[model samples]
Each structure stands twice: as structure tokens, then as C-alpha cells.
Target: MLSRLAAPILGIPRPAKRVIVLAVDASLCVLTVWLAYYLRLGEWVKISGEGFWQPQWAVAGSLALALPIFIVNGFYRAIFRYSGLAALMTIIKAVAVYGLLYASIFTAVGLEGVPRTIGLIQPMLLLLTVGASRMLARFWLGGVYQNQLRMATLPRVLIYGAGNAGRQLAAAMANSHEMRVVGFMDDDDRLHGHVLNGLPIYSPADLPSLVSSLHIATVLLAIPSASRYRRNEMIQQMRRAHVEVRTLPSVSELAQGTVSTSDLRELDIDDLLGREPVNPNLLLLGKAIHGKVVLVTGAGGSIGSELCRQILAVGPVELVLVEQSEFALYEIHQELLGRVGEAPVILHPVLASVRDRHLMQDIMRRYRPDTVYHAAAYKHVPLVEHNPVEGIRNNTLGTLVAAEAAAAAGVADFVLISTDKAVRPTNIMGASKRLAEMTLQALSAAGSQTRYSMVRFGNVLGSSGSVVPKFRRQIQDGGPITLTHPEITRYFMTIPEAAQLVIQAGAMAKGGDVFVLDMGSPVKIRDLAVQMIELSGLCLKSPANPDGDIEIRITGLRPGEKLYEELLIGNNPSPTSHPRIMKAHEEFLPWPQLRARLDALETALDATDLDVVEALLTDLVAGFRCESDTPGWNGTATALAANHA
Candidate 1:
């Protein structure tokens, strides 16, 4: 009934609200003065009492002092419901000043009928009444007293650390209506069983029991300084408990601000696969590109775009982006332009295929770049296996065109972005990449001004056609997570880290050097799927637990897919200046002999001779295994041959 009555008052105009509060304060002042007299005289007092210094005089004087002081101190201007400590302090200060002035005029001046004690007693009574009124208003108007009921409906969470970040995050979330922080779980034994800011600090070992007892739906990780391995362990523990987990970004990313609920992010999948990235060697990274014109082919691709971003940060004089797709080119170019901000670097966005020899030659000649990064290729294994001819034409033939153009244009350094699939090839894509590597090696061996090298690494997370994004989408859609094989494993890294390492590797390259990034231990496909499901607050739907949320489905392996990938074909990789980069000593064909075979392959490709193309690719690329009966290869080839005729 009181809340319904207060609702209309809350809806009143600001000016009317102020008038109402001012009138309330006027009445409070008069009542406090009478109460003071009644307390002093030990009897009821009336405002109509006689004399020049009567009770009526005291009421009028009190109002004159109190109302103006309250108004000037912003007492009437404050919104009562949202008022806090600062507002209360303003009240105390204003009342103290009013009390001092009232005492001087009424009591300290030695008035005959006024008692000096009433002056002191009246302000003290008024202070209590004024402060209590605001509190009561906040409770009634803001409905803050109902927070207990609201909190019960909010999702309960436990912070996974008790340090400064955890405390700050808890404080920031205190008013949040979405999630209620019930307690903290820390690894520290000393903090266990203790109370922090009225919340219990339980040991991490009790997470399973705590999740059940407290009904915790999520765990927020606040240990930003924790290593990747340590974080992965904690995440696994939460997963086993069947609670969802989110985390704060790295300490460096959190440097500029206090920990807040908005800063929480989903667990990074990359942390599950790799170790802490080593800081890039600034000198090595800036060696080839600083103050020099640079160009990157496939410039809008995952690795290619990242290379452009890092290269721009390295302060290149000019950055030319060569991409085949018009939309991809426009997107990356616009993004780079936003980051350029006052930097003198000139950006050139060119829409042209790397396979076009004349176009590539023209771009390279026009830029005469100091360094060229070749990242364009058809990388999806199954897709390339189905379209073998186009995959070979783009991956193998395109590298030859780009590298030769760079050399002919007198570009100083050329870097080809290779993959682990190129090491021991079973698929058309892998064979084509290996042949591209040979093209660069042969070019370097034939003695050109351009120094050609290749950087080979494993799968980059979040790339198009990568399992990471596919898994994320499946999880979001409440699905059956699909994998090619239960036993299959693959190496993974972040795109930015891969690009940074690629640049450093290219900078340290000598002629024909094949630099391989040291990808941490490969992660199994089944384990990855399970971890993803668990971290998403879900469980595997299997016979063992039929009530689980999502099922992990194993599809048969696709054509050209491998159970695992290798970074190097040969053994004994030598360490480079950077700890993460390794140089491999591998054999290659000389240019004269390789060129004749390449010419024959080109002729065979133009003639639509699928059988001859397969023979030449298998003969040219080491460890090449041709799947003659790969599902769609024969049908596509037949269609192409008939169309050509």
C-alpha cells in the first residue's frame, strides 16, 4: 500500500518533487524545535507559547535557517532513491552550519526566554530525522529492500580467485541483476574456509560439492596472470563439475581498467592447445619491412590480414594488399585505413589473382616492394581434394607466378606461407603446397636477386573451414559436435601469434630456408570436443549419461584428411634466433630440371589431362599419395574434358 502511494510521488515532476521535499523539511524543522523544548522542560510544549523568544519564534527561526541551508547544499536537488554516502555527508555538513548559526543568534547571544541547550538539541534531532527520511525514501521509492527476492531469481556464480581482480570484479557485479556472486573459490589454503566481503572462500577442490550445494551456474575466472596450462587445468576442473566457465582477458589487456563484469570473456580455445607465446624479437620483426615498401598476396585471408595489421604496426612506408575477392579486399583495406591513424604508411588495395602472371608481375613492378609475403592458397583439405585441378593451379602455379614476379621486379625478399600439410602429403592440397615450396627453392637455387623462403606451421584457430569455428557454431546451436575421427589430432595457434612469428621467421631467413614454427603438442579431436561441451555448461549425450546436453558425433574421415600433421619432412631442425622458429635442411630439385617438369605439368593442366596431371604431381612432390578413386574427382574431370572438347 505504501509503495503504491509512493509510486505517484515518484512520477511527479522534478520541480513539484523539490517543493514537496522542501515543505516536508519545513515541517520537520518546526517539529524538532518543539520536541527539543518538550525534552528540556519535561512536558509537552506548544508553538503558540507567549513572549518575544516564544516557541513560535523558535519554529520560525529554525525554518529560516534550515530550509535555505538545505536548498543551497543541494538537499532538495538530490534524488532520494539513488542517494548514497556522499549525499548523507552533504546533509551533515549543511546541518552543522545551520546549527552553528542558530546557536549564535538564539542561545549564544544570551536571549532571555531561549535555553542554549535547545539550540544544540534541536539540530541533533533534525539531523537524525533528515537522514532517516532519506533512507526511508530510498527503501520505499527505489524498491532496494526487495533486492533479496530479486537476487534469488538471478543466476548464481562463483569467482575463481580471491585476489584484487576477483574482489574488484565482485564489487562491480554487486548491483548486477543478471548474475549473483555467491562466493569465491581460490587455490590458496590460507584463504579457504574464510569469509571475504561476506562471501565464503572455498578451496578449489570443493568445486564439485559447491556447485551442487550453492547451485552455481557459472564460474568467472579472475586469475589473469595464470599461465595457459594452469588455466586449462582450472577450466577442466570446472568442466568436470558441469558448470559453465568464463575468464578475464590477459593481465596486459586488463592493464588500463579495474576489473568489471563486462570485461569477462568466453574461455579462449587457443589456450587449450598452445603454451604462452614468446614476445616477438623487435629487431628481427622490423628487419625487412621498417621504412620499406611491402606487399602481401592473399592479403584479406586469415593469416594475410593479420600479417598486414602487424606489418602496419612495424611502420612500413607502403603496404600493398593483393587479394582476388573484391569484397575481401575492400573489408581489409577499410579496416587497415582505420588503424593507420596519422601514420605516414600508404595503403594500396589491389584486387587481382596471384595466378595471373602478367597482373602479378605488373603489381610487383609497380610497387618494387622490399618484401613480399605470399599467403594466398586453397587451404581446406576436403574442398581441395574435390577440386584438385583448381587447387593445384592456384597453390602450385600461383607461387611460381608470384615469386618470379617478385624476382623480376628486383624485390629484395619473398616469403611463401606454407603449412604442416605440405610436409608429408596425402591430399591434393598438401601435394600442391609441397610443389609450391619446391618452386621457391628452385628459384633461390637458380640465383636471383630476390631471396625466397617459406614459413610452415599448423592450423590457425578461427580460420575459414577450421574446426574451431565449426565447433563453436555447433555448440551455440545446441548440437551434435562432429569430428572426422576420434583419434585424430591437430596442432593449433592464434592467427596474430602465427603472423608475428611468420614475420620474424621471414626476417631471419637465408635463401631457400624453410622455417617451421614450433607448434606445441597436438590436441586430440575427441578431447577438444568434450572440453568445448563441458566449458559451455553442457555434458556429452551418450549412453553413459543419456540426459546430457550435447552429443559428440564421429563422422568418417573426409578424402585427403590425415589423422595428424607434421611440420617438417626431414629430421634435425636447427633453432633460429627466435626460440619458436626452427630452420629445416631439406633437399629440392635444381631449377633447370624442375622447370621442364613444371612446363609439362602446365601443358597437361591446359589440355584437361587429369591422369597426366596426377602422375606429374605424384612424381614431383615427395611422399605424394594419389587417391585415384576420391569420390568426386572422376566425375568432375569427365565433365571438364567433355566441356573442353
Candidate 2:
């Protein structure tokens, strides 16, 4: 009803609005005068012996005073929708002015029968009526109009935080046509039963009941300042309640000082797990890759592709992608192409092997890439152990060729992607990677132009060969999920995050720097598998419970597998600006000695001398140890033969 009245007041064209404004002001003045008289006289009938209560005299005097005062104050001149602090001030001023005018009129006519006490009630009545009318127009009337226009039929939503962000979110949703707020759920007991924006705050424990009773289909998490662990816990709780969850982005993203619907996003898959924040050095990242022609070898592999993505964001002048696999190369190429858009940076996709010295040199010479991210080494442990000669040839010799090419081409920086297993090595793959790091240290000592470095970390989640994906597949296949050992554990990180840190570490490198990323505490594989199963809404199958959804079977450790991996080779690690990145200080053979060892090792690898290769690698890689007692030459002959052919 108020909305219908406000339409002509607001939308009846400009001239009509002005006319309605005058009428409303005049009507309000008349109402105030009549109210004052009625309160003073007690009835429409004249009060005997009270001259001031006489109808004609009282009515004429009230209008004569109130009308001029209302018009002069411009009390009805402002748009109600645009009314704010200014309008509020104007209302206060107009009421004060009318109060004085009414007092003066009563005084001039002589307060013969008019009681002075009746004048006191006039100001209070005027203030109440004027303030109430505007407040009604501001809140109640707009809502009514919006509802009449079908804007009130929104999905009822419950917010998860009842703090400042939640209250602001509720206000933002006031007129929203797609989402209506039911109330809030917070963990703070102090906030329980408190009302914010007319919505009650309930504890998280009440979520299920509240959701069911309110028919809530959506939940907005307004805890932008909450820690990741807390958010993860809330998400898990919400998921169990079968509520679809969304969240405002970090507080830093709220530039307008309020959370809008556009700022709310679907809960990311990463938020389901309690992942801690990583603080990387932006200066280091920019120093390493910005304005430089950066080359990423094996650019299509999981880690390598992520590296390419991060490097592109860091403002590299050119990104050279070198990979042997056509499909893998194409995938990364297409992805980068889409993200970089029409930026001036050149993207040179070269199909080549790091093992091809001439090809490596030619590409390096042609592009003169300032930084090279060598990530092409073969890394599967058991597969490499079974193909020792091929593994050594690629992982070791491939790194040597690439490093030498970088040196010859005078590249400013060369970063080798090394693995954690390279420390106290047990497998052929680990030994090969250790040898590659040795080769880089040797090359850096001998060269003047290139600064060689290696960034080493552990297993990344969802990478192609990581156990997480394998376990997922096994679970999906409705069978036993394979585990090497119940006690085995590995450090894990999301691939993109690891790669971003890798690039940032690269930017911090000096000559022969070995940067180790802080992979948080290692997780037991069996526990991880079980968590995945539970998260997938299934129970583990066991001998005791044959009818369970999935069975976890132990496959004894593989030939070259380790129960756990270490990050550093020595005790001395220097802290960097980034808390997660550290620089390792370890001994390296002098250039000439390292060069002679590499020469002999290459000859042994070429000749398929498995026994000699094993001995040479053990001698070269300090602290190296072999786990497998199998015969030394078990798989070398076939592997070498295949490589040569």
C-alpha cells in the first residue's frame, strides 16, 4: 500500500513528483495541527471555558504557522530513495523549526485557556510522526514494491559466519531476487540467540535442524578471515548436511568493503582439505623470469605444465616449450595459448629430446633463452630400476647435454628439476638424478655465464603417476586399491602450488644453488587412501568385512621404493625470503674431477656396462645407497639395446 502511494511520489514524472511532494507536506502539517488540538482538547467537541480550544481560531492559527514553516524548510523537496544522512538532518531541522513556529503562534494568541503543558507534546509528536514516516518509506515501502514485482521469491540461504562479514552479506542480499537469507550459523556461543539484520544467529551444531526446517538449499560461508583449517572443518560439516556451499573470496578481494554476489564463488576442491597458506617471494619470482626468454623442458608433463603456467604469469618475455611427446606438448601449448592471449611474448614449441646434444645446442643458440627449466628426466622408480641403462642415459646424460648447451649458449640461468629420492639414493632413478645435480654443479663452476640451480621437492597430488589418482581409479573400478606398504608415507602438495614455489625459488637462485621446498609433514599412504575412500562416500573392504565397498591390499614394496623420502642431503640449509624455500649447501666435486667422472660414466652407459655404471654412480653420488639386492646387470642389456636401436 505504501509502495502504491510512493510510485506517484517518485515516478510520476518530475513535475508530478514536485506537486505530490507539496500535497504530502501540506497534509502532514494539517495532521500535526489536528493531532496537537485533539491531544489538548480531548475531543472534537469544544472544551467549555477554553478559548484556545475554539475550533475556528485553533485550526486557522495552526495552519497559518505550520504551512509557511514546512515550505521554507524544503521538508518535502528531496527524493526519498536517495535520502540518507542529509535527509535525516533535514527532517530534524524541519521538526525543530515547526516546534518553534507552533510555540510562537500559541504565545501571540495569548495562552489564556491553552495549557503550557500541551505545547510540550507537540514537538515529540511531530518528531515521532516525521521520523516514522521516512523510515517506513526507506525500508518498508521499497521492500513492498520489490515484493510486488516478484523480487521476494528467492531461495532461502543460511550463512555460516555471524561476524561482520556475515552481517554485511545479509544487508547485500536484502533486495536480491535469487537468494534470501534465513539466518546465520557460527561457532561462537556468545553470538548464539543474537539477532543481526533481523536474522537469528545459531551455533553450527544446529545447522542440520535449521537447514531441514527452513528448507535451505544454499549456504554462504562468510568467514573470509577464518583460517583454512577452520574453513575446511566448516565445509565438511556443511557437506554432511547436504547443503550446497559457496563462499566469499578472501578479505583482500573485497575492494568495495562489502561482499557482493559476484564476489562469492563455489567452494574449490582444494578447500575441502586443510591446506596451509604458502608465502612465496614475488621479487624472487620476478627477478628469475621477468623479461627473460624462459624454456621449460618436458613442458607438457604434470609438473612441467604447471611450471609453464606460473612462468607465463610472472611476465616472461618468451616461453620456449621443449618436449618430445606430441600430445603432451600440444596440451600445454594450447593451455598457455588460451591464457596468455595476444601478449607479445613469443611461444616457441620445439619438439626435441634433451639427449640430442646438437638439437639442444641448436635450440638454445637459436632462441638464446635466458632461463632453462630442465624437467625432462624419466622419474618412475621401479620402471627406471628395470630399465637402468635407459634411465641413466636420459636422466643423467640428458641433463648433462642440456647443461652443457646452456653454458655454451651463455644462458643467464639454468634450473634442473630434481627429486627428493636423489638424497641417500636407493634406486637407479634417484642415482641418475643425483648425477644430474652433480653435473649442474660441475658446469656452474666451470662456466661464467649461466647460473645453475636445482629445485627439489616430493610427490605432488593428482600428478600423472602419483598414488592418489591410482587409488581413485582403483576405487572407481570397484576392486582392491593397491598399496605398497601400510607404513609407507610421502609428502604431498597440489601440483600447481608446488610449481609456483619452484618458479619463485628459481628466481632466488645463485650459482649452483640447490633449493628445497618445505613439503609439509609426510602423510601415511594407507591413511590417505582411507580418507579418499571415505570422502568418496564408501567404506573400505577388508577380510573381516568382505561386503565392504573397496578392498585395500598390500603389495610389498617395489624394488627401488622407499618407505619415506628426505628433502635435504646435508644439515646446512639457508633460509630465504620465502619461508617454504630453502637453499641447501652441499659439497660438489671440482669441475675437472666431475668432468672426468661424467666422461667415464657416459662411456659405461653407452657400452651397457650395468655393473660398471652402478659402481660409478655410487662412487659419484655421495651418501648414495642401493636398496635392491638384485643382480646388477639384470635389466641393463635389454634397456641399452633398445636405446641404441
Candidate 3:
């Protein structure tokens, strides 16, 4: 109740607050001077002898001189409730100067009928009293002590670094009532057992004991400069302790030299993956987009949208977003415009599917984009497997239309976003993307000015088809977190990293280059689920722990889903200029042969016979294997052969 009342007084207007502080200091000056006289002169300073104001001239002069000195030294400018050591030091300096000046004047005037010793005694008394009063206000009001008052409710947190970045973070959270910082965890042996900001610095090995004793529930990673691999190692240790973990923004992301509430957020899964990104090659990144007209197909999709962002950052002359969905198109277009506000890039949003050949050609002729990043495709595996004809029509035929149009328009660069599933595929989505890659390869082989290239990587971490989000949603809904298979594993990369490598890889293209990204390592689906649940401070339900918060349920793999995904069709990839990308020399059908097969594919697709399309894909795409040899598919294959015959 008392703290609540004090809050309003502390929150008063600046000028008013200063006036109140000034008045209090002036009264304290008179009181300290009178006390000084009473202490030094026994009978003369008695109330009956001089009425405590006998030295009326001295008390009046003290106020007249000391108030101006205190005001001049910015004593009142330092808010009483928030003032610190700096303010205390300024008070001492002002009092010392006042004493010396007053003593000099009185010496020349022979004490001016006042006690000589009062001048020396008063300065010392004033310094002690005034300085102490300022600190008392800070303590009484909601300053650092406020954090102490709410320590019972606030979660005890431990900071994970003791370096410069860690210190800045500590300063920001000094008076925070939401989380009380218990101590710091550092790897440096020298810092162990030492106190930092009133909290002990513990070694990494001491975290378990400290967390247990201190009842710490959260750990904030303040090592902004730590490598991803090192940070992940620390997080794994934290997870073992069953504590929630978070992190500060990276050094580049933090405001020049400060940390704030906005700079702290939950640790990203990419950080846990421990893949330290290689710095992008700026020259290669901008080679295709800088000052050139750039067009992105499926520009509103996850990968496409990120490509637009990176392209805009590279100073493209004009950006054309070609998306089939109207809402997705408008959303991305608005987001891009807002991000690049007033920037000199001309943005054009075209709501036309890549399957529309005439529209694709018209866009090509209208903009004549120097670079076209083809990101359009039906990527959902089960959905594409169920509707193979439309999948191939949109993915394969769409790429054909866009590639042919770009070639005819003499576009300088044509880059197709391919997938790891496209390699030795079993699903229609993968096969469609493989066929798209083949189309780009064949277009380049046909001797066109457009330099066709494709960048192949595994599943992006948060794309529309990512299993991560599905598991997250299921977890949020509270129940069985479904896993397709216990052994299923796939490569993962953050959206930004994949987009960056794509632009760099595309720019390095000599001709039809199949650039494969170095998708660090494959992560098992089961392990990923377990890690996510644990890091969220939740336990998984199993035979051993039947009362866990989240339950993991396994469902049989869907059609066209594989236990593992491969990034290369063959193992003969040569390294590119960039460390994390490679160029693969895969065999592609010549335009003459591929063109005839495509024509037959169109005829088969138009017939609406699923079996004929499957047979065509199996025969045309090398290394393509059927996920199932069900008796039904065999019967359909025979029927398809009879009809073709």
C-alpha cells in the first residue's frame, strides 16, 4: 500500500520533482548548520540562550549561499529516487566547495558574529545527511529494492555468460521484477566463485548444483558472440536440468551496445541445430539481382517470399512477384513494400499461376527480367501423391512454361528452387520437382542465352509442409504429438539461410548447374520431437513416465514418404566457391528427347489417367522407384499399357 502511493510521487513531472527536492535540501541546510553551532558552542547555542536562531545571520547566509551552489551543481536534476553513486559524489563536491567559500568569507569578516567552528562542522554534517537522504528515497521508492520486494514471485533466472555482452544484459535486467537473476554461468575458470552484480559466477559444471540450490527455472544465454555449436552444447546441458531456456539477440541484431526486453526472446530451434552459418559472399549474392530486373515465381510462398526480401536488399532495379494465390500475393507484396519503404525498387505483383503459359510469356516480355527465381511447385508429399496429374501439370509444366519464356525473352539467369526429395524420388511431388529440374537442364542444353541453374536442399524448418509446425500445433492442442515414423529423418535449414545460399549459388552458375546446399546433417524426426518438448519445459509420455505432459503417438508413414531424404542424385558433387554449396554434374535428357517425352506426358495428363502419368514418370525420371507395388497399381499399370498399345 505504501509502495503504491510512493509510485505517483516518483512519477511526478520533472520540474515539479526538482522543486520539491530543492525545497527539502534548503531546509536540511538550515537544520545542519544549527546543529553544528549547538554541538560546538554549549551555552550560546542553547535554546534559552540564543533560541537556536541566535546566529540568524549565519543560518540565513547558509541558505542563500548553499542553495545556489547545490542547484548549480545539478543536484536537483538527479531525481532523488533514481539517483546513484554519481549523484552522491556530486553532492559531496558541492558541500565541500560551499564550506571552503563560506569559511573564507567569515574569516575576512571575523566570523561576522557567528561561531567560527560551525563552518567546518556544518559541511561534514550536510554531506552525510544530504547524501544519505538521497539514497533513502531510492531505497524507499521503486528502485533496485523493488526487485527485492517481488523476489518471492519472480522466477529465478541464471545468465549464461560473464563477458561484455553478459554484463550489458545484466544491467538491463537489474531492477526487473518478472525474473530475478540469481547468478551467471561462465566457462572461464577464472571467473568462478567471483561475484558479478551481486550474483555469484558459477562454472558450467556447477549449473546443476546451482540450479537446484537456487531454484532457478530459466537460463538466459547472453553469449551473443558464441558459436552456434557451443551455444547448442550449453542448451543441451540446460535441457538435461529440465529448465526453460532463452537467448539474447546476436551481436549484429543487438542495438550497437545495449540489451533490452526486445532483444531477448525464446531460443530458436536453428540455434539448437548447432549449424554455424558461413558468412555469405556479398559479390556472389548481388551478382544476379543488383541493378537488374528480378522476377520470382510463387513469390508469396515461404521460400519465394524470403527470396523477395533478399532480392530487395540487394538493390534490384525492379521486383516482379508472380504468385497464384491472390491473398498470398497481396500479403507478400504489402510486406515487401513496407520493408523496402521508399527504396528505389519498382515492385510489381502479378496474380497469375506459373501454369498459365500465355500469362507467363506476357510477364517475361513485359518485364524482361534479367533473373527469374522459379519457386512454384506443389510440395506437399501426400497431397501431390494423391493428385499426381495436377501436381506434374503445375510443377513440371509450369517450370517448362517459365523456362521457355525466359529463354525466348533472353533472360540472363534462370534459377529453379529444387528439393532433396527430388533426388531418387518415390513421391509425385519429388518427381515433379525432378522433372522441373530436368526441364531447366534441357532448356540450357538446347543452347539458349538464359543460364539455367537449380539449388537443391532438404526441408526448410518452418515452411508450409514442415512437420515441425504440425507437431507444434498438436502440442499446443494438448495430446498425441503425431510422428509419421520413428525412424524418419530429414535435413533441415532455416528459411533465411536457404534463401541466402540459393541466391549465391544461382549467381555462380556458368550454365545448367545443379547446386546442392550443405544441409549440415540429418536429424531424426523422433529426436526432434523429444527435444522440442523438453526445451518447452514439458516432458514426454512414455512407458516409463506415463504421466508426462505431452504424449507422442506414431502413425504409419504416408504414401510417398521416405524414412530418409537424400540431397544428391549421385556422390560426384564438386565444391563451389562458397563453402556450403556444391555443383553436381547429373545426366539430363537432351531437349530433343525431353521435348517428345513432355508432349506424351501432356497427352497422358490430359487423359486424366493416373496410371499412365505414373508410368511415364517412372520411365522418364532416372532412379525413380515406386513406394509400393500394390496389386491395384500393377493392374492399373497393365491397363495403362494396354490403352497406350
Each prediction's whole-model lDDT (CA): 0.88, 0.78, 0.84
Report the C-alpha lDDT of model 3 over 1-645, residue by residue, as the tens digit.
877678677567889988998888888877787788778766436322354345666677678889999878877765753368777778778888988877765544545456677667877888888888888787777453454447768888889999888887788887776787878999999999999877889988877777789998888899988888988888898777767788987778875757875688865568778889998999999999999999999999999999999999999989999999999999999999898877799999999988898999999999999999999988998877766667889999999999989988889999999999999998888888998999889888888888999999998878996877787777778868898899999899999999999999999998889999999989998988887777666789999999898888988888888899999888899998899999987888999999999999999787766667768889888878878543225436445334434
Which run of 10 residues does model 1 get worst, by summed lDDT?
A: 627-636
Model 2 CA lDDT for position 370: 86
Supply the global lDDT for candidate 2: 0.78
Tens digit per residue, CA lDDT, model 2, 1-645 = 765675554445756766765666556655665676677768654523354454344445555666676667775555464346677777788778767766666654445555554455656676777677777677855655557456346778888888888888888887777888888888899989998778998888887787688887788999888877888888777655656678887776675666777777755444544767676677877887898899999998889998898899888899999999999999899988899887777788889999999999999999999899999988899889877877888998999899889889988888999999998888989989988898888777775578899999988877878876687788779858999899998877778778888887877777888999888778788976776565454577887878778889998999888898988889889998888889988788988998898889889877777777878877889877777744455443555555555
Per-candidate TM equals 0.78, 0.64, 0.75
In TM-score terms, candidate 1 sits at 0.78
What candidate 3 gets wrong by more than 4 Å, as runs, is: 1-150, 175-177, 255-257, 476-479, 628-645
Residue-level lDDT of model 1, residues 108-196, one tens digit each, is 87456667788889999999999888887877776744565588899999999999999999999998998999999999999999999
548 Cα displacement, candidate 2 (Å) = 3.9
As for TM-score, the candidate ahead, 2 or 3, is: 3
What value of lDDT does candidate 1 attain over all alpha carbons?
Answer: 0.88
**Model 3, 525: alpha-carbon shift in Å?**
1.8
Candidate 2's error at 10, in angstroms? 41
Candidates 1 and 2 compared by TM-score, better number: 1
Task: Please give the lDDT score at residue 239 for candidate 2.
Answer: 55
* TM-score of candidate 2 against the unseen true structure: 0.64
